[model samples]
Target: MIDVKIFQTPSGEYTGFQMSGHAGYAEYGQDIVCAAVSALVINAINSIDQYTEDAFENSVDPDSGSVFFQITDRPVSTSSQLLLKSLVLGLNGIQDEYGKKHIKIRLEKQEG
Candidate 1:
């Protein structure tokens, strides 16, 4: 299953997100759930990089099928925030379609 954790600030703003694990719905190359999740996340990351000036930190652990991203040293810009929200929307759609065993999403709160 693909596990996605969205981090929210105390005031309920999205601070970042961490996604790990594979859907295992099918083989790696053919898993629709994996493809959908990857498309949503990668598109968001790319959009943030291209359209926003928010300084940030991001890392990927291939061995663990994990990716982590967080805005660093500053608040996220409007464009980045939009992209992040879009990502969550897409992820939720996937979860609804594929069900929990294939893709799971949870929210985590972070104190200021």
Candidate 2:
């Protein structure tokens, strides 16, 4: 199953997200769940980079199917916030369609 962690501030603002594991719904190349998750994540990252001035840190591990993206700048920009929110929405939709067996999403409070 794909595990997703969405980090948020006390006031409910998004700060970042981390994703790991494969959907195992099908073979790697044919897993629609994984594809949908990848598309949303990549699009959100690219959109934030291209459309906003927010600074972020990201790391990807193909071997482990792990990805981590964090906004490094404080008081995140509205554009970046919206992009991340869209990502969360897309991910949730995938989870709802594919079921918890394929994907799991959890909300986490950002640590100091």
What's the TM-score of every candidate structure? 0.93, 0.96
lDDT of 1 by residue, 37-82 (tens): 8888888888888888888789988677799988774466777778
Question: Candidate 1: misplaced stretches above 4 Å?
Answer: none
- The per-prediction CA RMSD against the true structure, in angstroms, equals 1.2, 1.1
Ten contiguous residues with the weakest lDDT in model 1: 71-80
lDDT of 1: 0.86
Clash number for each model: 0, 0
Query: Best candidate, TM-score-wise?
Result: 2
Compose the digit string of candidate 2's lDDT tens values, residues 1-112: 9999999988888989999999999997999999899899899989999999999999999888899999989899998989999999999999999999999999999753
